[model samples]
Target: MAPIVQGTGEVIVIMGVSGAGKTTIGNLLAEAAKCTFLDADDFHPDSNKEKMREGIPLSEEDRMPWLQGLCDALKERIIAGKITVLACSALRKRYREILRLSDPDHLPGRHNCSVKFVLLNVPVEVLSDRVNNRLANGEHFMPPSLLQSQLELLEIDVSEGILQVDATQNPSVIVKTIGDSLIQTKASESY
Candidate 1:
């Protein structure tokens, strides 16, 4: 809990479809690590929010700019040597790549930033229930109807080095799992 990877320009991305508790888990992890926490939804343009509010699925074209902005923001934090935890629905391999800042063609310089992705893998039924509950409480703009589309678009590749956590567990458990994994990963890399 004492700053997981301080001054190491580490970016931890908590990813999954809506209702997977990305924001909640990400916030808790960041707090435990004593770092910055960011919710990707806040970066969405008003148009995108409106579309989701209307139960419309956004296309790849609709997401590129937003993703790019997130990448830029993350890059800045990395350069500043800040540890940042981002909660985002980085459902696609391409989107994850962008967030990783792995595209040499677009990168301004060699950034020694370490980006770790944690996927919150939850059961569809649980996701549905969570989304529905949020909808009923008017707590979010994303309607429950868009969940299916998000699930369909989700693509995970083992080669991405993503850490998958069973999201059905309690939020604290999920955070501890991720934190332990990250610590182990960092330790291994030091060799």
Candidate 2:
């Protein structure tokens, strides 16, 4: 790994459809930021995992508790002033909003740490191939059959503080791009 890039209290959510390299890229970004890496999938209940393993797409009702748990976990770290990289599907704007607005009572911008989203943009073919490979190796819980559903749910807008990157790029290159982008954005914000 290259020298770690120093970072402030920031929560970076690596997001996209299944097989978009969210976990791989998020881990690398966490390493570059010298912070902890978290996989949102880990927070999923056994039932949720089973649903995905069975090629079932989770409904919004099935996701609320899970999303809330992730929000609480992020709040815990942010309040402690720790930087973190989390890989979450967060396919809908409401989901991302849940991840963003840590405290309902307080203004969105007054959170202890900033939440930035990184969307991995990959072609459908490439995503399918990656998911297939992972399934073939018994390395992932998400069934390749659900990729289309995830893609359908994905709502992206780079204008909304979501940094978009090519998922087909090397992990190192992806990490560097996200790191540089965050640094540049933060610098400009301070101006």
Best candidate (score: lDDT): 1
> What lDDT would candidate 1 get against the real structure?
0.88
Model 2: per-residue lDDT, tens digit, 1-191? 34334434568899999899999998878877778999999999999999989988898878999999999998887777677889999999889889986533435544333788889999999999999999999999988899999988888755466888998988898888888887887767778
> Candidates' TM-scores?
0.93, 0.91
lDDT (CA) per prediction:
0.88, 0.84
In model 1, the runs with Cα more than 4 Å from the true position are 102-113
What is candidate 1's lDDT per residue for 1-191, written digit by digit as tens? 55686765778999999999999999999999999999999999999999999999998888999999999999888778788999999999888778878322334322333777899999999999999999999999999999999999999988677899999998888989998898888888789
